[model samples]
Target chain A: MAKKAFNPDIDAPEYKGKYSPYDIIKEGTIAVVVVALLTVVLAVLFSSPDEKAVTIKSWSNATPMDFAATAMTELDGSSGTATYGPPYNNAATGQQVGPLTLAKWMGINVNVNTANDFVVAPLSTLADQPALTSALTTFASASSSRRANWEANYSKGLSSGSFSNGVLQVAAANAGPLPEMLGALTAMARSGALDQALVTQKGFYTTDYTKPLLFMADGSFLANKAQVQHLSGDQWGMMNETGSYPGQAWLWLYTMWYQVPPFSTSWGANADALVWAFMMLLTLLLALTPWIPGLRSIPRKVKVYRLIWREHYKNM
Target chain B: MTTEIDRQWTTRLRKRVVETLPPDKLLPDTQPAYVASWIYVFGVTTLAALAIVILTGCVLAMKGPLWWHLSGTGHFVNSLHLWSVEIFFFAMVIHLWGKFFMAAWRGGRQLTWITGVVLFLTSVGAGFTGYVSQTNYDSQWISTQAKDGINATGGGAFFNVLNLGQMLMWHIVLLPLAAVALTAVHVIYVRIKGVVPPFEEGK
Candidate 1:
């Protein structure tokens, strides 16, 4: 028949005895003031936008040959994004990860043929030029190794090549139908018509990786001329530069992981897997901290929370 | 005699129960043993940063996507938004790590821990959406590239990166709402349960 007594320990000290509601309001007011001050300080100092003009028209005009070379290089699987697996393009079955079962479960979703999409498709629009058209058709039909050999030869030739009055001339041995095809592409680029070719796609127009990757990769050309004036991977952080503007510096943590040798030199897919694994480990550590022996002891070890409630503890 | 005995027994039982209660339990006298100093402000600092993000995000949404390119005021507002986001994630990461090391989720507060993890995931989603809505050439590229990953994983059917309209809607409305909702629930639970008393005190 006896009633249970309410335990006072269950009540917060701030709610007890002579403490007024104003005490809570006072703490809240201080917090608000601190936040407002910080926000204003950040807004004033870093307010300038990083906006710089970067359009396809401007870029193609500035570096026509470079653009053409890039387009051609992509056609030969030497472009940085050419063989980027999974998200950008589907890897060949042999190049795919995991056993047959897992690979099949995921499947090859983002199917892309860099040579076809980045080169042949665009050149198809320019098929009226019989000579250039024939070169593209021949290059497209050639074996991958033969194309690779040709590009390798051409790329090597460019190392010692010279330019005269906007004309790039390489050794006659390296000068083949590919160089002539590149000339037409360069002329098209200089006129700013290349943008149209780069973006124009067939089918439902669901996805266009060409423009974005091109926009990122072509700093030697026009679009990123102002923003990513520096073409090194370190300067642009392995992604597209957003005008002249600052970008996600927080990504430093992620990109820094790549700057090291093993990650930087590893195969593209393997590097991605490494980063993904690292993130997974971090997440798991965070989730399991409560049960982890050394981690669970940290609060008591640090005793920082005692300082957080010092005034209350002082009275006690 | 029976009525008197019953009444006496009830009175005795009540007194015994009162006496058995620990003195610290009877009075709110046991102080929190964790640090209660001004340096603990980082936790609240993070929450403040999230507040800035929400407020600036609201203003930007009211003006729409082209605002950053439309007027000087709009551009400044957009700058504020970008800075707020930078600060929010920065603070969130620090706060999350601090909590992790402090074992702040101990003593039957697993839900708080899980909710924090969910908030982190939601924030990343929000960040990705925000990046896409920038509408720059970079935004254009990131969206197209990110779609491949999303599509490959069968997430494209639900979350289409190329659909600017869909992305803008999620960035402004859906994802933010989910983030705020999750945060609110997390906060309420924390307040109700109160901070887990220092680990050693139980031992």
Candidate 2:
């Protein structure tokens, strides 16, 4: 195919107008220096938030019962990760946009088995202890009915506020080996080994934090901390900075969807999917504003350009 | 039909480069007096903020996230990186609005406009990745929160926000480099195009 001629008139419009000597280097240098000073002054006046990272160890230590109960939820396949279909598991239906099953189409790529990944596997390393080993054996070998009964009984005990001294003080009946498992898991978590255990991957480096993070999300501990910082979904959290600081204000358009209408109130509203789709559509709209009939006309309709280059348009 | 000289990649590229950005066009010491508008200053300010962000990011990269958490100087540098980014986005938005009203995309400078818009989009991704890489509670909350949206769009398979190493590399290496390169191209186009002839008297 032959290329079109590069017309100087169209490609590079000739400039025949007033000119001013502009020192690009000097202007750039001044801007940089001014910005650097501003950054330094802001940094000195208001230091960045250094809130320590939340670890499984801290979560388990501070609130063992929540950690233990959350573990039980993971084991029974009732936790967020357990039921979070697609890219993880299929316990629950994946998100959709109208008839389009967006998440299910992506499929389960991360492959998280909440029962094994979140609980059993992490506890397997501690099998040297007779109680834990026996508990694991009992839990693993038990029939589905028996395991379910045990979990139900333990969960009931938990609801009754039977926990005493980080040990769930459940009545012996129907509890089976659940107490042993929960006790051992709590101990492991408090000892800070749970953090290491959760991240223990196939390779020498254990950087992928999917397992640990999923486990955290299953519990209210992390969520509560976020709420304290005003970083919750309903709080326009995605754009908020920690504490009283202003967050990524540019995200308002994206986060605004979460605060209103069908997204906030609809039972089937996959907020994430809906928001992502909306933003993408909006971005494309903005990018094509020049081509879109009404949007393209907005610049001329507003006439703000006259104010911007008032000096140039003065003769009009 | 192609000669060896014409077929050479460097020769073709050089010719195009020089033709498009001749000496004066590439580095002009003078600009149209119509560029006097205060709105023009925001673009330069945005670039200035980006420079600070990159410099502070480099320092943070050298010492790692842990050092930034513990050392006072590291904290200050990290803060600088954060604030610079805040300013970068802030100024860029203003510049974007200003140019939009001016119909800066007029003439054959559509590529220039497109590049600037794309640069802003990439910077948003870069900023989000930076937040996720902070290794603080904020990062934890944000990444886990963000993963849902990304995954819903089928981006989780590759762009796993929970993966610290992945997000870190993107923040420090990939996104920044893409943004910087795009910014360079955008600025070159601006220079070559000679800052859209201010909307004339009648048309």
Candidate 3:
């Protein structure tokens, strides 16, 4: 009789050596019970972190001057939201990866007109006040240069301005109708109407939060809160939890890129795009490790499997 | 003479199933003695954690996001979901490390190894979307920060984290479904392939 050729895929040789009874259901049930008990105990002892959702109402209430100042920035088109480019607007060059213009490639899909969406549109809803109505009309009717001049002067005045009792008191300036419009906008925000207006689209669901977040991010208030919570980009914010709790440790590999040079310091480094692309490559390499010539050899070379199955080898 | 029924699609499928997984192998009551190791336990533990995660997630969905904020019971459920996810990743990483060291991909089981890695990648998406669905300051911050990276790759147009509706659906429906499907495939492959053998000094 001819002997069968060795087939590495076949496990008959290992199966022939020894076998032991294994109750998979019993093992699985015990694991489930242990995990469930652990989850319940942890849940009861340390509920979840439920930091309240930040809204225009909370933000304006917390720092009214910052709110007023941010409104000025929005009108002058100086805020980060105004010049973010692509999905929001096209005022400045966005981040890039190598020679690829990534932000430009996805050009303005969300079509956010920062001035219109962030300030004008939300404020326009409260047209009951004659002063606000007139301000809106005047601001809309002004020439581009005149509007720019008005916004610039008003923005300069805001540096020394103070907010009190729902009113923003700034030094007198040639600011068209900006101050009155902003005052009314502040009242609307204080009443929580601005938050509602920013999100309430023509739909049954009202969950879109782009405008409100953009408004908050342009000012120092939200970033300040984030820094206190250790959620800043430079702080490996993506991998952190709100308080001192466990975070997504699997994300360490992805977040580590942001700490290194080129991603961290290079002016043109589209850290987001570059990091995402690099992660994709890494994930692919991981998925194909068995086929990669050098990588596939590492497992055999390390000889760690010997330790894992040491008992089995000893028995043999 | 062999009949046409011999080549029928169902017959062929049944034959393939039997050839690949005989009943004794598919639902084996006995494992090779080499399977005796503590490291082997992590895989089942990860699966257990996943079950808890999914169960807690379902409870959260039933109550709605706002309800969870107001109710104490909701907080506990939310915590369970969070910690289960934490534990899931913890156990999964250990499982991955153990398997890698053991060269579990040997014996023509490369597909099983690849599926496991793919499942890990899918789970990351599921977890990130869960963060975006939290509807709190963290959600706000994460969505804004994550959008920059996604937009850089031109994914911002479709996968806008700021769109709560999109993220919620992905977290509760789409991504979870994919993760579960990938997991099922991974487990089925393991059943078909059987556990890898211990390495020896020579072939």
Please write out the lDDT profile of model 2 over residues A1-316, one tens digit for every residue: 9967643223334557788899888999999999999988887888788678899999987777788889989988888888888878777557777777877787777889988887888889885698889889988999989999988988888766555675656564688888888778888898898888888855557778888998998899999999988899899888898977778999999999988877887833587788778889999887776666777667767888778778766733
Structure candidate 3, residue pairs in collision: none
TM-score of each: 0.69, 0.94, 0.94
lDDT tens per residue, model 2, B1-203: 87999989999999898998998887789988777788998999999999999999989989986789888899888889888988899899999999888777777788888898899899999999999888999999999898888878877766788888889889999999999999999999998877987654452
Who wins the DockQ comparison? 3
Model 2 per-residue lDDT at B192: 81
Superposed model 3: Cα runs more than 4 Å off: A1-16, A267-269, B1-11
Can you write out model 1's per-residue Cα lDDT over A1-316, one digit (the tens) per residue?
8954432222112233123122333454676567766666777876744344344555546655465567666766766556544334554322222332222345444455666765566667775788987787787687777777777777777556655576667664644567766666556666666666665575434334344344345335432443354423445443434544456655555556656767578545444445445655876776676667676566667776555445655565
For candidate 2, list the clashing residue pairs, or say none: none
Give the total clashing residue pairs for model 3: 0
Instruction: List lDDT for all candidates, in order.
Output: 0.60, 0.84, 0.84
In candidate 2 chain B, where is summed lDDT lowest over 10 consecutive residues?
B194-203
Task: Note the DockQ of each predicted structure.
Answer: 0.15, 0.60, 0.62
What's the lDDT for residue B3 in model 1?
67
Residue B18 error, candidate 1, Å: 30
